[model samples]
Target: MPHTYLVFVWHMHQPFYKDLATGEYQLPWTRMHALKDYYGMVEMLEEFPSIRQTFNLVPSMMVQIEEYAKGEALDPFLHRALKPAEELTDSEQEFILKYFFQANPSRMVYRYSRYGELYDAWRAAEGNVERLRRSLGAPGMRDLQVLSQLAWFDEIFQENDPEVRQLNEKGRDFTLEDQALMGRKQLEIIGHVLPAYRRMALKGQVELSVTPYYHPILPLLCDSNIALQSHPGVPLPRRFQYPGDARLQVHKALDYAEEKLGFRPQGMWPSEGSVSDEVLALAYDEGVRWMATDNGVLGATLSSLAGVRETYRPYVWKQDGREMRMIFRDHFLSDLIGFVYSRMDARAAAHHFLDRIRENARVLHNEGRDAMVPVILDGENAWEHFDHNGRPFLKELYRLISEDPGLSAVTVSEALERIPATELPRIHPGSWINANYDIWIGAEEDNQAWEYLLDARQTYDRVVNGPEGAALSEAGKAMALEELLIAEGSDWCWWYGPQHHSENRPEFDKLFRDHLAHVYRALELSPPEHLSRTILRIATPAYQQPPSGLISPRIDGEISSYFEWMGSGIYSPDHRQGAMHGRDNAVREVRYGSDGQKLFLRVDLEQQKPGALAGLEVRVIVKSVRHESELHATLLENGAKGTVVRSTRKRTLGAEVSCAYSQIFEMSVDLLSMGGRSAEMIQLQMSLWRDGLPLEAAPAQGWLELVPSEPSDWE
Candidate 1:
């Protein structure tokens, strides 16, 4: 049959957030996206069963979603948002103000009157939390908290669920009970995320593929030196030659997909469409029959582009008796949806996309050759910027495709089956970005990060290969290797360098260092001092600074001396979008220090309270590769000592600690438990809770790091 075979591989991924040493999830992105994107992306397909597409699910992302779906992940964002507004502390309030409005304002926030009003007030405040807090007040903040979560709920849920629809109707002045219900509803929606995809895959409406475990650049992992072939004279990081690691990742992807999807996926989308000759051979050896990357890689490999004839055909990369089918994505058509279509009317955008696709295939159809147009891009991130999460456009696109006879929306595997494969003699070693590894390796920060990783990998090899490794437990060996693999993922470096920008860059940098440090900590060895510091060679102007020296402060609510915190590291929360992530503020600043024996933390609120502000309380949390502890205290409760709950590598709680609050909030924590090295990265954060709802938090953009004791250090 002469048809334009459209293969859509929607790559869905987010940064790995789980701490290898502790089972805690560091960010709420995976869970948050599940509410808006994951379930609905597949469930929407049932309406147009005639159209089939491929979804490239990263195993790590699926793990987080499954954890969330089972009511297992402890999401701080969800807890704070659902908390009763009256009881929220200054920190919780500030956190809600900053993060809840993270959606595209016009598309998501401004859709509702209350959310729009709050967002406008937030913008007027110019990142001043106190001014914003004063303008919006608690009632306004509460309305925003509810609406933010409600706005992200899928259109299906919005239309079908009575309570959800009722809340949408109410739109303003929501109750405490309503906030709680929304929190519960989020998990309820996330629970359907996996099942929806599974059902659709089970019914053969879609095919599920996977990226390599941890989503590392497979080509770079096989040999970092390959990057030079694609981008000549680029400042190179030390060679990270490990084809075995690349193969293991591919093997794990197949094993995990079979376990989760009931069959080993034949198609693999090398992370970010990254590939090399070595990676291709590794994937094929691991039983991958086909893979898809960007047209750029195909363009670079084939060395010339002779129009749609070169791009719109399936290619067989066969060399040295190893062969695999490959599809080069239609970059122009894919970009129209991912970057351009969001601004246009939904029906218009969908029509324009189809028109371009049909026009592209006309010459092929005239020559009696079926056009294999592979459209590939991110499945999740682009929608939030679009009107109604791009549902109307997708529905319109799906309907038009269902009605069209000359075009057939098919999976990558289906498209390959219908087209004769052209032999691709070779491929350029590069990623989807500019046909090079520049995003992960070129800049000063990226190069420095890669060098650190190489050092960590060398240390792991030395330790595991030495005679001392004889005493290393099997668990310890596995942990060290696992942490190393996670550090090798492409996301950490994505935030590094000059190419991309994220407010969470510091957090990403710290996590990457932490992962490298854990490779040592997992073996009960001391990590190098370099890992204790920031890898961000450059950053925004200062208000936040690392610790200069050590200090010990009293736990009393009142400040006793001016010099008490003089030497401590400080985080004056900057709510400006680029400086830190939060929009509203209740917490003014946080001071971090360690007095050789115990870690010290002091939280300063925007305003001082006399004794008890009705229902205000504070929670101090510390997370490290060794242990995770959370402490709590009621506002100005003179001698009322606070309690602690801890999480360690065993993922169990077995700790009791104390803290005090009155004029100021102060606490001391034993950073490590169970007689282990504490060289891994430490994060400290304080949030205010009032009426059982979190109000504000210090260092709202990300957590403050508590350095391994010596000279005090915190970022």
Candidate 2:
């Protein structure tokens, strides 16, 4: 038979979010994903007997999930959500209003009626979380509480489980008893997640793999200097070469997965698919049979082979009496499912994917070689943007795959059993992202984070090797070392650079610094004074870039010209910041600038259908220290017409607000008409709406304020 192997590895991971000093889980992602993706991702595999996939479970995430299953995690969101609505304190109520809606507006929130209603109310209040909390009576609060939790339930449970079905069916006016039941069901569901994956592995429907204990970049652990090989001249921190930590992380991951899943993980997916010769040697020594990385690494390692054929096959690194099999993921195919398919119709998307796969298979067959396609991506974070949490798309894709005789879905090990791996003398030193460690290092924030880690590590060594060493028990030193390992995780730096954004980034900074502090606390010593303050140099105020100079762009709802909006201020929605990492990014950014005559605004959206932008209402609000101005327009299908309105805080602006639509949404209003002429400073905010519900808002925190730079500023 002509073989076409499909290797699917769903990389499941989350950072160690706990602060040992306070025993607090700084974030709730692990628990949230457990309820939403972990079990269901594997559980759905049962429907197709012929398909087998790999699930790469990271140890740090596993530990958190286990704690949540036992109801021992001190997650503020979990505790706050379950508390009776009437018993919530002012702060607690405020927390609920702020964080409960940290979800996708189109899918997660709008999928349910009551949740959408509550969210709409919260949005219309315009930052009045406390007022919204007060306005929502006990019944409304209870409904919000129950629905927030329910919105994250697995697709299978939402449809099949009787208790879950009833609560979802009840939909509104939840009771105290209902909240109690909701709490129990959530734990119960989390408890089943691991065992379900184990069952699938045992039944031969799936294979399980493991990453490092704390999901650190193993190459950097071995030698931070290695980063310079992939990215020369990238500024680095003080040398931090800890091969011992890298060895321990790999060894512990295999042991932990064995203890938790009842079998040793045969394959390894290094954190971020990062690999180097040193890291590979460690994995091979730890008894790992095969490991996987991204296509960029493969391309960089073996520049001789052409693109597609070289990418869709396995390879081996044999050097110095050690051998490790490797698979390079098809980054484009993996990203299509991760970032692109969610915006498409399930059937059309699935068929489009199948067509591409078939073409790849045909190409390989003609070349007298079999195709081995490796698709890998984050299992949890991409789903919220998907329809029904990506279940429909997966089902359709899998069904088409199963019906095709030329395609066969297989695990990494099974694929290795059938296809031979090409040999390579050396491996590249980089990660799955752009084939560089720049995401975790190089940038100012990233370099500072590493320096902090180096300082803490040296302090621990000093405590152990110095005069007070012999008196210290080994357990206490080990405890301190464990905290250091937790701090070494790549996730801390993942949020540090200009690359990503999250509403919970402040909490991440606190948790990382707290871990460093506990390294000393565990050793019975005081943490350094510098460690008391945050390593995050700039506090994130929902991210903004100020305008440089005055501009007079034609309001034609198009780019007009590159120079027309060249110096325009960009007010990107905080929610859209993670587009590169697969988060909900419906609208890309809001471009605004002003001239002597009028202030102009443009809304840029992600790729959409012809009529897709029509229904969305683009609303812009401008406020001076003295007055406010508003512009409202309902985009029509032909990109032709919309209703225009002008209003202010005190009274209507009455001036004509010009609105237009084409490739972008553009509007302009005279400054004098909006009361900005004599004002000290002008503040702008913009939002997107559909069906009376707010889809997204730019400058999610604080206003986009500027002093209205003079036209000569550009000169």
Candidate 3:
């Protein structure tokens, strides 16, 4: 039996982070991601010549790239984007010299013609930047052309350039501006890199698609209330009717794709395969004929709509009883490649992927329906894990698929045109994250966060709905909208994971409160006197301080402070762990608590702790379950800092401190290399240590809730 396997990969993303005022990106990961994967994948297709795939470029990411394309001095922007390393390793410095245009022959030749050396020499000299600055005078679109030309030269070192080393350095500190600039550069590079794809796409060799701006979870974006309830403490990054925002995102993204690629994309890939009826309607409003979600969403939808067996293939999603040609990705296979195949040899993995599709096609043939397999996944990050940098695996997969007569590949848009509008299913409101929504919800800490958000949401509604809110001016409305957008960020809730609260809970609370405060002010509402001071207290630094009963250890960087009360009106260290994670170079900052039952420990991570492990392990005897016990860990590192509870047990308070350690390698050293369930368990334990000691122990005046895990044997 012959079957056409349509492998469609919809790459969806947003700027890693956005500036509050300018809406500009603050992190380059998004743009760098496009350059490394989105553009790379498109360009790679030139080799297959016949292979086709779908991509969804978010408008927000494109906007940043566009800014790069319009820059006056590419070099300065590039330098700003790629923050200079504070202390580069010898190897890193060598790579910089080896790959940079000034030192590397390949890069110099690729970027410059005969003048490459002159440009390189100018770049090498401190005065040269000033000279080049004078020569350029002002930044503009033409400067982008010059930069674009020079970027081509950088291809020689694009993969091995020193910038990546800094980006990957988890423990290093980066200034906020540097982080923002890096993000801009990353996007600019992507804009520059995409021309390679635009060339192919222009030649009708590949197909492109667009997604909603910022790549937010569409269903959540459409309705903040849903997110608030499902994931209580999570902050919404933007404010607006989600449906309207989603429509805007899609329209803008599609428009940008058209402008950049010289053609409108035929389909759309909702961010993270996130979807729902509201999202579907927004897609319709945006003129997007097709969208894709994880196969799990489709199956769940089919079970609700038809109560029949569902298959992983392209289908038409209908709204108001109308067909909406939509596609479902074989998430299992897709994840296998994106998550697992990278770990396998290219030949074996590629063959296995093809075999899986072949098996699925055979099954579809029996069912008498043409099967379209969307083998979509991240184009970058996944590649680094592959041997030979994913070249072998990708090349092999392309070779086999293109040459195999039995198999055929088509872009998602083209495939949709071939399929007829059929019976539709109700897609459950969800995303490709955890099925239960625990990733974004269910943590107690998150619940607390949500309580704050709910207040903000309600207040905003009142302001807009009430006389005060109605009094807002156009400028006021815009400012309020900006505040609302920041409030909707998903990072706040996401920081708390797998349990009671995320470490970034405090930030989430602050952001939500601040936004509400702004809305309140815009509406000219005088808080009912009492609430004014309370709101101010929550919104101001008055309510924030270091934890109690902990001593500061001598370290070089910054430290984080965390404290939480679970109804008792007493600060307990255990309850506050989830409020801190990913903070670097921490020593005890301050500790404040009264009763022996309650304690606060403020830790700081300044200089690197000598022989610091990524995490630590502590043990306590498991006493009777009657005793209430909890364990939390904090990291004081770089500029960002926080704390998290590694484990909690009643009567079994003994657990390890689960700090986001400085040495991820040391954390992985114990377990990742081996197999077997018990071994894996042991490895997992090693990776998630609760407590014992810091990588380096220091003594200061802070409180410690150090306790035994079990009760006395005599008792």
Identify the candidate with maximal lDDT.
2
Report every candidate's CA lDDT: 0.80, 0.82, 0.47
Which digits, one per residue and each the tens of the lDDT, describe model 3 over residues 1-715? 5466666674645433443433434333444454545556666676788887666666665655565556522332244324334333333322232223322234223333433533454456544334443443222112222233233322223545466444333212334443454455454555555676677667766677776655555666566455553345755433334466556666766777777778777677776677777778767766777777766666566554211124445577666755567777777887898788866777999999888778767766777766667766655556545554566788898889888887778877677666544557556666666322455544554454445555555666666767765568867666655455445545455555444343224434434444445544454542111111111111111122322332322122223222232111111122112111112323322222222221222232233553353333321111112322223333323221222232232222222212233421110011111111211111011111212211211121111223211222212
lDDT of 2 by residue, 198-219 (tens): 8999998899999999999999
Q: For candidate 3, report its TM-score.
A: 0.56
Whole-model lDDT, candidate 1? 0.80
Score candidate 2 by lDDT. 0.82
Q: Choose the strongest candidate by TM-score.
A: 1
**Deviating ranges (above 4 Å) for candidate 1:** 540-715
Q: Tens digit of lDDT per residue, candidate 1, span 572-601?
A: 765444322232445567888876556787
lDDT against true structure, model 3: 0.47
Pitting candidate 1 against candidate 3, the one with the higher TM-score is 1
Residue 348 in candidate 2, Cα distance off native in Å:
0.9
Clashing pairs in 2: none
